[model samples]
Target: MPTQTRRSPPDGYYRTTVSSLAIALSAPAVAQETTGPDDGEVRAEQIADERRENPVDSIIVVGGRIDPYRIAGSADLIDSEDLRRFDYGDVNRVLRQVPGINTQEEDGFGLFPNIGLRGSPVERSSNITLMEDGVLIAPAPYAAPAAYYFPAIGRMQAVEVTKGAAAIRYGPRTIGGAVNLRSTDIPADGLAGYAFGQYGSRDYYQGQAWVGGDTDYVGALLETYQQGSDGFKTIDGLPDADTGFERQDYRGRLAVHTAPDAPVEARLEFVYGRSDLEANETYLGLADTDFAAEPYRRYAASQRDAFSGEHDQYRVTGSLAFSDGTRITATLYRNDFARSWSKLQDIDFDGDGSFDSISSVFVNPEDNAGALSILRGADSFEGAVRIRNNNRVYRSEGAQISLERPFEMGGARHNLAVSVRYHEDEEDRLQNEEFYSQIGGDLVFERQTDLGQQANREAKAKAIAFYIEDRIEIGALTLTPGLRYEGIDLTRLDYAGSDPDRSNGPTRVRQTNIDQWLPGLGATYELGDAILLAGVSRGFSPPGPGNPDARAEESWNYEAGVRYRSDKVQVSAIGFYNDYSNLLGNCTQSVGCSVGDIGDQFNGGAVTVKGLELSAAVEPRLSNSVSFPLSLAYTFTDAEFDSSFDSEFFGDVNEGDDLPYIARHQLYVEAGVNMGRAAATVGANYVSELRDNPGSGAVAENERIDDRIVFDIAGSYALTDKFSLFARVDNVLDNQYAVSRRPFGLRPGVPRRIVGGARVSF
Candidate 1:
């Protein structure tokens, strides 16, 4: 298996909300619950703890940033603290619960998980906009780049996701939405930090410190973390894989607040991380449950492998306040990344007997004198046979800018934001001797050997976009309306490879796509402190044909919701519907080129998705001594393909089939208990069955996975004001499932596991 690019951040909130509610619900379950910051920066050298659990239902933004509530679109927020709670094995799993989100996990951790939102997968860059600290990360607007790195929550506050046109404030690529990760506040005084743990050999460590002086440049802030864990799997016939994983995160920042009366500020920020872990291989789904239970004898061979990768992202941001409530912000950044790996597999043909390939020796045929040679009758071949090799390395650099203005009226305030971004990425893809082995045994093997080659392809793209938004506030009402425009030029030149000849156009092609406009709107209402209401302006995703000159994709969405809360209770309910045009799906093998003739092709079409999300939470004291907290969330979704041709590739999938990966129902319930210094909680999340894909490639007919329920338990005890002990157990009951299902049908969920550890502060 190969190492993948940074997965989504562990900052997703599902686990934290469930865990907290579970402890609150237990009648006599005594435990403590906790909350962490979700906005602003940590002072230099200040150790900050933050979490974004329950991101979609509970989140607030200031400074005229994106407004998630008023936009009728769908969105969610993940806090930093929640990310620390899990073993942090796979970040994508933590994000799968968000509405309109789906994942593509090919051949396990060896490949990056591609994100799909609403009905738009990451395949086309024309729609979705991905940002870090408000800067676009992808080098190209209509093209998808594996996200660079997952920033540790140790230095972050929360991740806000704005879906649909409501996300227009960020720029043109936001047809589907935009993702913004907020940085933690910088401290002014000194140093701080915390620690915690769970079952499954999991542990967490973090620390921070600050230094500031008066009448001079304020240079302050330092933060670091070390985390590791052993994993779970109790079933037989399953690989006793080591859930061994480790991470190191470091950050330093310097701020200069000169001329206290002036509204100008400058900050220098740096971040770095390295990770090493075991890559879990997924079992391709078997034909039947009974078949899955049996370890069919193989040709005396099995396969196993492990991998690791490292990344670095650095940036400098400056803020300047001009006259008349206008401000300008800009950031310059560069990201560096690298990864390597290999696999060992025992081969068996006919499922009857195991035999070493005589060919393994042609390159290094050294040892072997046995019945095996005699079995081949000695006349056909000679000597040694044992192994095979597979190995690869990839890297990029980018810059961004934005401006904003504010307006106020009748106790209400409004802020408008606009921005543009550009990036240049160079990629190198590699494969070795293994390529020759696959086509070797044939009669033309000699010719193939002579044609063996090693090469690289350099792809460069330039994307530019600008957008404007108007936010209005009047008493209990907040309204936001916006529009965006975008343009791109993409070109690929093969240094050691030739462009395949095509019947419709020149074999070597050059293209460019430009759009003058894409528009959006959003609004929100507050009914006192107990009830808040909202709805979005619109949602859209434009398509991008792979050719630089292809047409752009497009889509629109509508949504409405409300949040009701008080000191003792909180409830949120939402309903949404989306319409998509020129939606992209599995393209013909000629387009994607990975699955042979089995893959579908991309084409212009329409799709609709409608769903409802409802959640409620209560905090009530039992009798007069015990406190209980309870919460529940459920989802109902109906998504389908409207009208499309290309039957040779899609078959009968048309008009009203549910979109793949969008579960019809997802429910979670939990409770927590608190008693002085000790506390505990338990919760369960149930997901209704959903298709991993709309069935594509060779496995389409035999593909179908089922609904599953997973239970989790966690607790922590405060030993002293400066120290604590904590532990958590996940996948209780040892339920077997998969966070990702492989193309061959294998289910790969983490096995039952436990993690525990301790922390201290000064």
Candidate 2:
């Protein structure tokens, strides 16, 4: 077992009296709540089996189920057991521990994930490729990638993140890397089922159950999760309206041998999700002073905001095995999503027809204090409020086929793979605006906008892609080289400000095509007892249609790392550099960008991102019935703009300025004790200060989100072989820290919450 040294605490004064924990008024938290790891790096069985093997041995990992030791890329695996240990219902909270990925909490609900991979823009997770069951899962990957619709992480079986040169197989946003979520596989043996539920602060509630079984010729699984909450923030003078959300998710799968003796297996799956929310969320945020005074308060202007949405997916998959180490797998899939949000947009506080966007008022509060105070019900104001009904419908479907074969040639071994995919996606957006007259903090319906639609447009893309890769091995060295080809036809029709129904005007249609070849290579060498790896890849992300001169976001990405593995300990260190020729950002209406429609793009000329990641874990062999587990992860990233350019979203930027919101340093630590059927774990996380704009030395008070440190603890006790009691507490420190400085002012992290529940298997 690996050993660790502990240091004693420094001598300090001890206060005579004690309190629960330090909490910020209206700050909503007592913790930094940084993400850490459990036993979630790999599958429980796989990790156990590999622990007994040589560290340098090649074995399939959860990342594409590819052999990690043989690949030249960086990958991280999040297993199911780890999810249970962390109670990972929030994707942003858990992914924080995964180095190279930066997360910004939007609305604190994990409802819409905003993540940037190695310096990609952290908006709606549009810069990276998102997949489920090894298939594309975004609402519209090619046609439009902004304003994403994220998946619920509570029900996922595993999450596989592959970065740098290793992500060549996935497109069209290869520059940021890929996140693939693997769903639970149906049982191949006897019946199995489990159910669990928990209740937390702010009326939070969660419950889920799943059952699966297999027969001689058929296998089936059924699962459902229903969760909801009455939100934390209350609106002034409107105590009756709840400010939270509710959602129900269902998934089912059936696999049939069809011909029991045939060499093929097939499965069909269906996934359905629906959610309704009456939230007080808005683009408006408090000023620095106001935040310091009341960080959790909501203004009266946004009392009427609400949202609702639905998503559905259907897929058919099959696999074939041949006699000589060859196999083929294929899938046909389709997804549909629709959403509508009714919220306040602009306010004419003085009835002056000269309206100010709510976002502007929040971002520049010092100049808009009069209007801000009036909107907060501090003073009377005669004005007309502008409300926009934002609605959109999306559809995506695709077919993919892949082939794999292994053979030996010239005294060496080689693994070969080939695949082809055709995908099509479309987005239809039609929105309307309604005017209201405000008197005494209450709104009276005035009239609908004479302009047909606040936002009206459609985008579509049809793409064909082919990929091939070869892995060659000689002695203790392995090399992999891969290539991918993408050809896409994109089209957009803008009825901007006109009715989508063609009732009020004509439409302007535009078309564009993009073709590119992306290449990647990786090498791994097994040393005396350690593993050395290196890789380089060409990354690509295409611009949406309608912009004839919009160049694709391209980069040369490089990575190198080393790893050591054993039965009791594992460690790894990796470094990556991404040199970008172009970076892209889209104006999102939700973020207060109304210069054009929702899908407009702005290009940032040149950028560079370099980072380092370190990780270690140890599980010492203690007594026959007791053992301890500890793990640590750290990240350091230096991201900056290489070219001086002006961005509509980020304002002005000079060369050498740090990119917005990319934390320079992050650290995570976790320790746990296991005694037979009972287990306890505690963890802490720290993140350095982050900036919202490019600036010189010190982080300007206005452009900075303060650093944070958070803690968490959880325990589970098994009463029998089939049942267990569990409890958890988050933000144990109750530290108040800024999680985001976008969409307006500071948005706080999740507040302190305690939950207890039971897990039962039958």
Candidate 3:
């Protein structure tokens, strides 16, 4: 209906003071009985008061299929037993412990991070949309749409983070939401299983077996895993000299449960991957007063090489319920990817050096009058000086359709839906040449530059979207709202500087022009059961039309949050403010312009981000099935950088500042004590400190990265009901930090490690 102008205030003020104190303390809350004192553990204190009032039932496959207090926006869910007590091998560090996720490191942890939301444009925010079951695995418009490229979150069972409800059934970049990865079908009857273990040279295994009955169908799932380490922190003298990692994943699902006047019901699915790794360089480079006193330093020894090479994804989704209440659903998907990488750089010289050390400077190649010496029979010159390589390949095909029916107005009771989608993304890039060897660099004096360049880029982007949604129920009141429209087409071809022994000539690459429209909207209100949601959306990324005058980045998100559950506890709170515009970066050369465009600038003007979030959960009833769960989440951000324009050029940018990896405050706390066999959880996360990178400059600054606080402790034991046994201790007060920040100006994060495991189900 496109019409909104109600800036806040008007939605269950603590549910009208808890329904006027339940009719003014109705009979002392039922004679204040319910004795306490762990007496036979009253169902573990009612499941810890239902996990602290209600963090959505502490996890029940996202509360019997969504109704997050009637949903308006903002969502989160992570189960499958908190992914094995947080013993993750980077799903971007488990989405940085939630709360507006942010992680964009340039090195370490299997390299390639970079995922920021809310503050928008963290270098092309694909508007956020990543699905798994409903299909849609982001390969759109080329590069960077990662789900940690599969190591199979031990065979994922749950992970849904909507942030902004439905988003018109998932489209238009979700405006800044959508993260589905549900994979636990369970319908073909028979067979089910699992297995796990930990602490360094780690071990993990998974399994699933399904068989159908009554009118045949099929199913499949196989998983494999490996993690290694006889090292943990030390170069040269070695100890993690070159980190380790390994993975192999596969999945398949088939369905056909139709009959009873069949109206066609079909399904198909397949997924596969092979990930490999080697890492070391978790942000090392200090000197700002030693990173203001210890920020985890170790400088030099960068080596990470990944090879996923081939990945195949396919889907056919289905839905067709009818009998006049009409309904139709569809989805067809495809994804293919290729990856390659190499990095080998080592250095650590500063006398007193001997972490198993040595150094050299010049040897052979010549000294015939260019005067040079320091080849002390040389020591640490491990060749292959510098090499940054990447070979990419991607392919995609898409299809989508959705429909629903039912109507009635005035007297109210409507429910309508619509959706459409079409997609295409093909990209190729190859750049190689850094087989270093320069004892003399074929030179006479000392003037040579070759920041190694030999590029070859290709692109083809396409997009089309459509959406519509409505839901209105009378009585206690329920109103849902939605809308979406999107269209984009971009292409690129730079090939860097098509080498012909370039002399600064053929360096003209630009292309871009094709962006139709983008839109979004949302709403929700229930009141009776305590629900209130809000939304406003618009998102875009457009650029790489092959550089054609690159300039396309937009954002608009305004949100409201509220959710309350009863039966013993669950609370939620959200507040957002996002408004950005044409923000892209890389305008090299001391913040000027025209100079290989540094990395390619953008960020012309305007930027704002306000935030507020709160979460609470409780479950108590210490008896029967024993339970005790607790959860707390809090977020507060005040991103900045407002007004702009002056031929851009960034640099100590003013008019507000802040915003460079973002961090105003973030927190997460958890407590656990379950006994449906055995369980234990202890969690902690607190982040704050980061700001600087307005084009680097300030007592020596550039992409600042220093701020720490991360703690984790886990435990599990089931041994029956399908097996289980796990353990974890990550950074467990190993302190020493820098969560993330490093673009060229290095300083990565991720240290302190320990893992243990055991899981088996059948």
lDDT of each: 0.46, 0.73, 0.51
TM-score of 1: 0.71
**Candidate order by decreasing TM-score:** 2, 1, 3
User: Which TM-score value belongs to model 3?
Assistant: 0.30
Please give the TM-score that candidate 2 achieves against the real structure. 0.89
Better of 2 and 3 by TM-score: 2
Model 2 lDDT, full chain set = 0.73
Worst 10 residues of 3 by lDDT: 356-365
lDDT of 3 by residue, 1-762 (tens): 121221223244334434533443342223224323233134333333332232221111323344574455676777666665665655655665457655444433433444555554343234466666656665543323433243344455667676644443564454456566666553344555444545552222223333322234545555444444433333322334444334444455555545433444333434443444443333223333433454443333332323345567776666655433444567777787666554322222222322211111111113211111111111223332333354566777788766655444455555566666777776665545343322332101222223225456555666666666666666655566655655555545454444534344333333443433454555667676577778776655444444334455566778887788887788888798878765655342212233343234455566777888788888887797888888777778787777544544455576676656666777878788887777778788777666545432332333455566777777777777776677777667777655443322234355556666566655
Give residue 201's lDDT in candidate 3 (0 to 100).
Answer: 29
Residue 516, model 1, lDDT: 43
Each prediction's number of clashing residue pairs: 85, 7, 65
List model 1 lDDT by residue over 580-619, tens digit each. 6655554421112222211123554677777777767786
Between prediction 1 and prediction 3, which has the larger TM-score? 1
